[model samples]
Target chain A: MALIGILGGMGPLATVDFMEQIIRLTGAARDQEHLPMLVANLPHTPDRSAAIIDGGADPLPALLEGIDLLNRNGVGVIAVPCNSAHHWYAQMRAHSAAPLLHIGEVCAAAIAPQVTRAAVLATRGALSAGFYQAALVARGIEPVLPDREPQECVSACIAAVKADRPGAAATHLSDVLDALSAQRIDAAVLGCTELPIAARELARPAFALVDSTLELARETVRYALARGWNRPV
Target chain B: MALIGILGGMGPLATVDFMEQIIRLTGAARDQEHLPMLVANLPHTPDRSAAIIDGGADPLPALLEGIDLLNRNGVGVIAVPCNSAHHWYAQMRAHSAAPLLHIGEVCAAAIAPQVTRAAVLATRGALSAGFYQAALVARGIEPVLPDREPQECVSACIAAVKADRPGAAATHLSDVLDALSAQRIDAAVLGCTELPIAARELARPAFALVDSTLELARETVRYALARGWNRPV
Candidate 1:
């Protein structure tokens, strides 16, 4: 399998969560059987949500630096765990030597197979950017976004998880999911990386949950493993 | 703060555990407040335990390659999550411009503050190399290693974790700890990275558990945070 690269540290904990998901999904019995990963946890990058919503410092330079290092080290495929960072995806991919996986595309593809209507649980910046929305629309699936109140709930939830408070975010998350279930939503896309951590605290929700982080990981693994066995012994 | 670097993926999950520990210890409430980390999750490097005890392929070249990448990328301080890999610590540190944190030294230092007699729960390779043992002795502490049967138990526990079976390893790990407690052991250093995951399955053993992965992570965070803030404004 080709070595996988992760441009992470959008929020350090989310990056860790993404890596854990990849490890879990790989189901490798031996360390060597697991897909090799090179994770650039360069978390000091300016906040993507803040940058897009409130004119914060641009995180593009830092993102480029991380991608360049991964490329220089010869990673075969790269994936960024942060959804908000995908606002600069095209630019980052254009500059990268390796292919970068699109979180939205993967999540949409995963969703298209099963549900027609799904709620997008994401950062306000990512919601405003409409990447996941556009991807689902292109696939002819309806993408439901959090309303202003629910968006505030998501923002608070993400902030709590960033501060290492997964439990604190659970109540608000449950309320958001309850609202979605009321709308007869078929599933919810955990479009933001941090949302998945908060989702863990909830007892299986009323609707199916499509985890964007896990989907990206699953896709990354499939993409890498599919790249032909290491040129045979 | 200086950028922190982790030479990880000796076993990918252990590496993630180490990163999570670092994040937890940093107490960062926001993305920027967290230490900037560059993690090289390059698991394709030959197995450290096999390389050591079985006379398998030397992992020195691979270790050095990963270290060199960290140095090249301007990480101010480096730490390795894998205890067994410390067999080549001196050589790896020698090849890099950045300082590599010693898992044993940090672990022993953390242990010295409270305990005098500590158990070293590690792979056969690490015990044979005597890195943890020597560090404890230098700190004027007694290092208790597993006897032949206990060593096999420790190995089995580590294998179970590597194979993603923490529950299956819990019984044997408890037995090993019970034996250590019989000898008046005050603490046990989880010298193998995988052992920490297995240790989690046990409900606080009678003796203290000194996790080498967590110790290394704490040291790394302290190292980077103390490195004189990234050139004041």
Candidate 2:
């Protein structure tokens, strides 16, 4: 079996959250039965939102460095858990040794069987780039994107999660979901990884939630288990 | 600030749990404010207890391989969140480029300020090695060691956490804690990294609970914040 690589830490906490989902979703019965992952948690990568929203420094060099380390270690599958980082998916794959798993494609696939229209909750960069929106459209689903005001709320909710303020994050995130529910959207695509922390308490919401992180994890697991990295020999 | 290295994934969940603590403790106000961590989440590490208890395969080679990878990456501080892995602390440090933060020593420091006697809860490998016990003793604190029965409960709790069964893990861990409290112990040292997950809901407990994972994370935060990794430059 090949090594699994996670080029993560867009925000340190979100990366760990993604890892937890991978562990839970793997359903391993023991320690060794779980996947072998090498995580390049490079939090110093220039902020993806800042880079895209403003004319800030490119995160490409740092992202490539992480990929190089994973590639050097002979990672069979390389996965980037951050949704916003997918803006550079093409460029990242161009310099990679292994195939990169697309979060937007995975989330679109998860949302298709359940919902007709989905709300996109992500960073302004990811929203403007339309990576998730394009993927959803490609799957024959209507993308219910937030307007300017709601996009500001989405940004705040993401920042709150990064600051470890769960209360304010959840409150603001719930408001965004409620507003989208009023639009007759059947699902909300949490296109930003940090947003999932805030939406964690949404038990039976007004609409279904397609967590990009979870879907990406599910895809990673499916890709891995099929390759027989599920357990030791 | 130097890049932080975490050689983790003894049980993948335990490593993620520790990373969450670090992020929360860092008090970062933004994504870039968090620490830059490179985690080698190698879940395929040979069972530490099996090696020490039943003479199974030596985990040192794999342990050294992880350390070498971190060394090559130019990390300033290396931390191993697993208590059982500390059995090879000296040897690992001998091969490591960066100084390894000793989890037992950090836990002993956390326990020394408040308690006279501390209960030791860890894996069979860590228990038999007496790393945490010796650290407490060196700090002029008496170690309230669990008897055979409670140790069995501790083992079961660790196994349950690895198996992703919270109910069984929590119940067995509570039993271990209750037995320690009956012995008039001042505090219980969660000498195992996985034990903290089981004890998460023990609010206002019967005795003081010194979590080894949190203490190690706290020490890591202090070490990091001093070097000005608390926020972006």
What DockQ, on C-alphas, does every prediction get?
Answer: 0.66, 0.78
The most accurate candidate by DockQ is 2
Give one digit per residue, the lDDT tens place, for model 1 in A32-151.
777777788877788898889899999999899889988998888899999999999999999998999999899888874668888899988898888989998898888888788888
Q: TM-scores across all candidates?
A: 0.95, 0.97
Question: Mind giving the per-residue lDDT tens digits that candidate 1 earns over B1-233?
Answer: 45687898778889999999998998888887777777887777788888888998888988998898888888888899999999999899889898888898888888847688888999888888888889999888898888888888998888888778878789779889877777878888888889888888888987789888888887887776677422223
lDDT of 2 by residue, A1-233 (tens): 67789998888878898899889999998988898888888888888977888978899998998999889887888889899899999999999979999999988888757688888899988887789889988887889889888888899999998889999998888878767767988888899999888888655587888888898889888888889886665
Which RMSD does model 2 reach against the true structure?
1.5
Residue B81, model 1: lDDT of 90
Query: Poorest 10 consecutive residues of model 2 chain A by lDDT?
Result: A201-210
User: What interface RMSD, in Å and to 1 decimal, does model 2 have?
Assistant: 1.3
Tens-digit lDDT track for model 2 on B1-233? Answer: 57789999898999999999998898888877788888888888899988987898889998998999888887889999899999999999999879899999998887747687888888888888988888888887888778999999999999999999999999999888778777877888889889999888555467888888999999998898888865555
Residue B198 alpha-carbon offset, candidate 1, angstroms = 0.9
- In model 1, the runs with Cα more than 4 Å from the true position are A112-114, A228-233, B112-114, B228-233
* Per-model i-RMS: 2.3, 1.3
